[model samples]
Target: MIELDGVSFWYRGRPDPVFADVSLSIGEGELVLFAGRTGAGKSTLLGTVNGLVPHFTGGHLEGAVSVAGQRTDEHPPREFAHLVGVVGQDPLAGFVTDTVEEELAYGMEQLGLAPQVMRRRVEETLDLLGIAELRRRPLRTLSGGQQQRVAIGSVLTTHPKVLVLDEPTSALDPTAAEDVLATLARLVHDLGTTVLMAEHRMERVVPFVDRVVHVPGDGGVVDGAPAAVLRTMPIAPPIVQLGKLAGWDPLPLSVRDARRLAGPLRADLPAPAQPEAHAGAEVLTASGVVVTYGQTVAVRAVDLRLRAGEVLAMMGRNGSGKSSLLWAVQGSGPRRSGRVRVAGVDPKELPAAEARAVVGLVPQTASDLLYLETVGAECAAADAESAADPGRCRALLDRIAPGIAAGKHPRDLSEGQRLALVLAIQLTAAPRVMLLDEPTRGLDYTAKAALSGVLRDLARDGHAIVVATHDVEFVATTADRAIVMAEGEIVTDGPAREVLGSSPAFATQVAKILGEPWTTVAEVAAAVDASAGRVR
Candidate 1:
C-alpha cells in the first residue's frame, strides 16, 4: 500500500542527503519496523509517508512517494489525512484539545464524520488503546505515557488506511506498551491496517513486526525478515544479541526462541557477581511528601532517602506517581504537604534558581528546559548561569550525545538530541542531587549506554541521582537501586537486580533467557568470558 521509488531527501545548505536512493515498498496490511540509531533518519522516513517531509518540513525531495494510490508530493499533509494517521515522537506538541475524550474525537470531527460515527470511533479507540479510564482527565494532568496513548488513540479514531508512528511506545510502561502493540497487531491481522513504526526499544516490537527495515546511517536502507536484517545490524535487541553471543543459528528474535536454545549456554555461564552496596553519606531526605491536584492525590504521604553516591530508579505503571513524586521532590510541582531537605536546606523555600543549584531536574519533556535558539547558545547560557567553565556544557553535550551541530536550533533537533542537550545543561549546574524523569524516552541504545556511563561516573563523583523511568532495560543496566511505586506510594524497594529479576513484567530479555541475576546482556557476556577464561 506504500511505495517509495528512488527517494532521496536533503535539507537546505546540507551537501549530503539524510537518506539516498531508498527504493522500498510496504504491502497492504504489513507491519513494518524502521530500525536505526538515533537521528539516522528514521523519523524523517516516517514523515515522508504522510507528506510532512518536503512539503511541511521544507526539505528537497527527489523521486516519488505514494501511499494508498496517493502521491505525497502532489498532495499536502492535510489532504492525505484520511489515508494516513501520523503520530510524532512528542505527543504533547501535537495535541489541540484539553481533555482526553475531546482530543480523541478531534481528528474525526476534522474529517467531517457524523457525530454518531465520531462518538462510536472515540469509544472504540479509547478501549482499544486502553485509555477509557482517562477519557475525562485533562490532557495536561495526565502522565507522559498517558499522553502518548491519547495521542495514538486520537489518530486511531480516524481509521486511516496507513498508520505511521514514531517511537509509539517510548513513553509507555511495559504492560501498556504490550497492550498498544497487541492492539496494533490486531489491526494488521483483523482489520488489514498498515503500520509503519520507528522505535528505539526494539525488544518490545521485534517479535510483533512482520518485517524489519534497518537504516545504518550511511544514507542506505536494508530490508528483510527480522533474522536476516539483524545479523549485520550494528544495534540489536537483547534477545538477538544473546542469540548471536551464544552462536545460535537463525538468531532468535524473542525470549521464547532464545530460551529453547539457552540450556547449554546457561549451564556454562557462571552466576553474575553481586552489585556492590553504596555506602555514601545521606544527601537528601524527604518525609510526608504529598502532591495533590484538587481531588486527585498524585503522590501520597511518602518518606524517602538518597545517599551521596547512589543511582535510584523509580519505576511503576503510567500515572502511578513516579513523575509526581519526582516533581514534588524537586520543589517544582504541587506538594500539598512535604518536607524536602537537600544539604540541610529546604529547596521548596528557595528561589527557582537556588533550588536548581541544590537539586537539578531534567523533566520528562526535556525540551521544556531548552529555550535558546541554537545548541551552542543553550550550552553557553547554561555555563553562564551555573558559573562553570566556558566550554564545560559543550563538552558534556558531546560526551552524552556526540555529533550534535553547535549551530543547529534546539527546536529542530531530534527528540534524543534534545534530551541530551537538556541533560548537558542540567549537569553543568553540578547539583548535589539530580533527578531525571523518563530520561531515555528517545535515546538509542548507544546514547543510553553513554548516559548510563555518565550517571555511573556522576555517582562515583558524589552526586546522588534519582531516575523515574519505564525503560526496564535501562534500569537494569544503570540503576544501583530500584523502587517500585504504585498509586502514589512506594511498594517495593531493593537492589536493582533483585527487584528487576523478581518481577516478570520488568525482567530484561537476558534475565528471562538465562534466569535470575542476569538482568543485562553485558553481565551475561562477562560471565561467559570468565567461564571461558577459567577453562583455558
Candidate 2:
C-alpha cells in the first residue's frame, strides 16, 4: 500500500537532511510500527506517505514515494486523503468541529458523500471506536483519550485503506491508550485495514506488531522483524532484556512470550527486591479538598496525605482529576476550598512561589522549560535562586541523561533527552515534597528507568513524592502507595498492591494478575511462585 525508494528529505534552510536514503514498504492489510527515539524521522516518514513532507513542510525531496500506488509527489494532501489517513500526536490541535458526531461526519461531508452515507458512516465509526456514548458531547468537554478516538473516527469515516498515527497514545493514560489501540487492532484484524504507526512507548506496541522499523538517529533506515531489530538497538523494553538474559533465540517481544520462555529460568531467578519503606513523618495533608473550574468539579471533597520518603501514585482514566488534584496541591489550580497544608502551612494563603519552594513540581510538559542555548545552562538556571553546587547539577544531569552533551542547545536534543534535562533541573531544588505529572510520558524504557532511579534516590533521602499518572506499570514497579480516583472523587485509596488488585478494569492486565483483595502484579506473581515452588 505504501513504498519509499531512496527517499531523502531536508527542510528548507536546514543544514542536513532529516532523513536520507530511506527505503521501506508497507503492504495492504499489514500492521507496521515505525519506532525510534524522538526526532529520528518517524513522523516525517509518515508525512511523506501522505505528501506532507515535500509539500506542507517546505522541504526538498529526492526519490519516489507512493501510497495506494499513487505517486505522493503528484498528489496534494486533499487528493491523497482518500487513500491514507493520518492521525497526529495532538488531537486537540486538529479538531475542527464542536460535537463528536459532527467531527466524525465532517470528513465525509467534505468528500461530498450522500447524507445517508455520511450518517451511516458516522454511526458505524462511533460504534467501532466505542465512542457512541460520546457522540453528543462537545469536543472540548471530552477527555484526551476520547478526543483522540474522535480524531481517529474522523479519519476512518473516509474509509481509507491505510491508517497512519503519530504517537496517538503519548498523551493518553494506559487505559485510554489501550482502548484506542484495541480499536485499531480490531480494524486491522477484522476489517483488514493497513496500519502504520510511530510510538515512543515500545512496551505497549511490541506485542501487537509483526515487525519493527527503526529510524536511525543520524538519518537512515533500519527495518526487520520486531525481535531481530530490537536486539541491535541500544534501547529496549524490560521483557526484551529478560529474553536476552535468558538466551532465547529471536528474543521475545512481549511479556507473555518472555514468561513462556522463562519456565526454567524463573525457578532459579532471584526473588524480586523489596523497596525499603521509610518510617517518616507526614509532610503534606489535604482535608475535604474541593476544586472547581466554573461548574466542573475536578477535585470533589477529596482528602489526601503524604509522608516523608514515600512514593505515592495517583491513577485514573484521563481527565479523571489526577492532574487537577496535583494542581490543587501545588496551589496552581482554580479556587480551592477546605484545608490544604504543605509541611503544616496552609497553601491557599501561601503564595504559589512559597508553596513551590517546599514542593517542586515536575510538570507533564517539563520539556517546554528548555529554551536555553545549552543543556548546562538550563540546569544551572533552574537553580538560580539557591547556591547550588555546579558539580551536583552536573552529576544529576549526567545521571538521568548521560547520552546527551551538556554543551549542546536543549532544542537540538531529542524530545526524551530534553525531558530528562528538565527532570534533572527539578531535582536540584531538593524540595521535601515533589509533584510529578505523568513524568514517564514520551520516555523510552531506558529513560523511564533512569528517572525512576532519581525519584527512588530522592524518596530514600526523605522527599515525599506524589506522581499523578495513568501509567499502571510504572505505579506497580515504583509506587509505595496508590490512590484511585473516578468522576473527580477518590474511589479507592490504600496500599499500592491492594488498590491495583481491586481495580476490575485494570487488574486483568497486570503482570501478576490477581483476584479481589490482591492489587498488584508482585502479589499475584508471589502467590503463583509459592504454589509452584518457584520462589527463590
Candidate 3:
C-alpha cells in the first residue's frame, strides 16, 4: 500500500542528507513501527508518506514516494487527506476547533462527507478512543493525554487507508495507550488499514506491530521482523534487554515471552535491595491546594511536602490532576486557592523571575519554553536570564543530549531533542525546586537514562524534584518516591518500588515478570552478575 523508491532528502544549506536511498514498502493491513534514536529522522520519514516533507517542509527530495498508488509528489497533502491521516508529535498545534466533538468531526467535514456520516464516525471514534466523557470539554481545558486522543480521533474519523502517527501514545497513560493501540490493531486486522507509527516508548508498541523499521542516524534504514531488527538495535524495551541479558535465543519481544524464559534466571537472582530513605530537610511545602476551571475542580485541596534530596514521581490516569497540581505548586498555573512555600517564602507572592529562581518548571509541551532562532541562542538566553556563566546552559545541553547542532532551529529539532533543550534551559536556573511534567514524552531509552542520571545528580546536589509522567518504566528508574493520584486527590504514596510493584497497572515489565523489588532490568542484571562473581 505504501512504497518509497530510492528516496533521499536533505534540507537547504546542509551537506548531508537526513536519509539516502531509503527504498521500502508497506503491505496493506500491516502495522509498521519506525525505531531509532532521538533526531535520527524517524519523524522526517513519517512526513514523506503524506507529502509533508518536500511539499510543506521545504526540503529537497531525490526520489519518488507514493501511498495507496498515489504519488506524494503528484498530489498535495490536502489532495491526499482522504487517503492518508497524519498525526504529528504535538497534537495541540494541529487542532483547529474548540471542543472535542467538533475537532473529531472537522476532518470529515473538510472531506465534504454527509452530516449523518460525520456524526456516526464522530460517535464511533469517541467510543473507540474511550473519550466519550470528554466530548463537550473545551480543547484547552483537557489534559495533554485527552488532547492526544482527540487529535487521533479527528484523523481516524476520516477513515483513511493509511494512518501515519508520530509518538501516538507519548501523552497517554498505560491503560489509554493500550486502548488506542488495540483500536489501531483492530483497524489493521478487521478493516485492512495500514498504520505507520514512530514511537519512543517501544515496550508498548513492540508487541502490537507486525514489522519494525530501524532508522539508524547514518542515513540508512533497515526493515524486518521485530525480533530480527531489535536483535542488534541499541534502542530497545526492558523486556528485550532482559532477554539479551539472559542470553535467550530469538529475543523475546513481550512480557509473556520473557516470563516463560525467566523461571531459571529468577531462581539464580536474589531479591532486590530496598532503596535507602531520604533524610534531607524539607525544601518545599504546599497546603490546601485547589485548582478549578469554571465549575470543574482540577485539583482538590492537596497537601504535600518535598525533601531537599528527593525525586518524587506523581503518576495517575490522564487528566487526574497531575499537571494542575504541578502548576499550582510552581505558582505559575491556575490555582483557585492554595499556599506554596519554597525556602520559607510563598512563590505565588514573588515576581515571575523570583518565582523561577525558587521553582523552575519544564511543562508538558517543552517547546513552549523555546522561541529563539537557534539552539545556541536559546542556551545563551537561558544563561543570561539565570545570571549564570556564559557557557553553562550549552554545557548542560551537551551533557544531557549530545550532538545537537548549535545552528539548528529549535522547532526543527526532534520532539525528544527539543525536550532536552528545554531541560537544559530549566537546569541552568539552578532553582531550589524543579518540576517536570512528562519529561520523557519523546525520549528513547538511552536519552531517558541520561535524563535519569541528570535528575539523580540534581537530587544528590540537594535539589527537590517532582515529575508528573505516565511512563512507568521511567518512574521505576528515576523516581525515589511514587505518588498515585485519582480524581484530583492523592490515593497512594510510598517508596517507588513498593508503590509501582503493588499496583499492577503501573508496574514495570521487569517487576511484572519477576515480581516485587525487581523493578528494572539493570537491577536484575546487577544481581545476576553479583551472584556469578560470588560463585567464581
TM-score of each: 0.98, 0.85, 0.99
| Residue-level lDDT for 316 in candidate 3 | 98
| Candidate 1 C-alpha lDDT tens digits along 280-318 | 999999999999999999888999999998999999999
lDDT of each: 0.92, 0.76, 0.93
Model 1 spans with C-alpha error above 4 angstroms = none
Q: What shift in Å separates residue 535 of candidate 1 from its native position after superposition?
A: 0.7
Residue runs of model 3 more than 4 Å from their true location after superposition: none
lDDT of 3: 0.93
Model 1, residue 446: what's the lDDT?
87
- Residue 484 alpha-carbon offset, candidate 3, angstroms: 0.6
Best candidate, lDDT-wise?
3
* Cα error of candidate 3 at position 81, Å: 0.5
RMSD for each of the candidates: 1.1, 4.3, 0.9
Query: What is the alpha-carbon lDDT for the whole of candidate 1?
Result: 0.92
**Model 3 over residues 401-491: C-alpha lDDT tens digits?**
7899999999989999999999999999979999999999888888899889988999999999999999999999999999999999999
Ranking by lDDT: 3, 1, 2
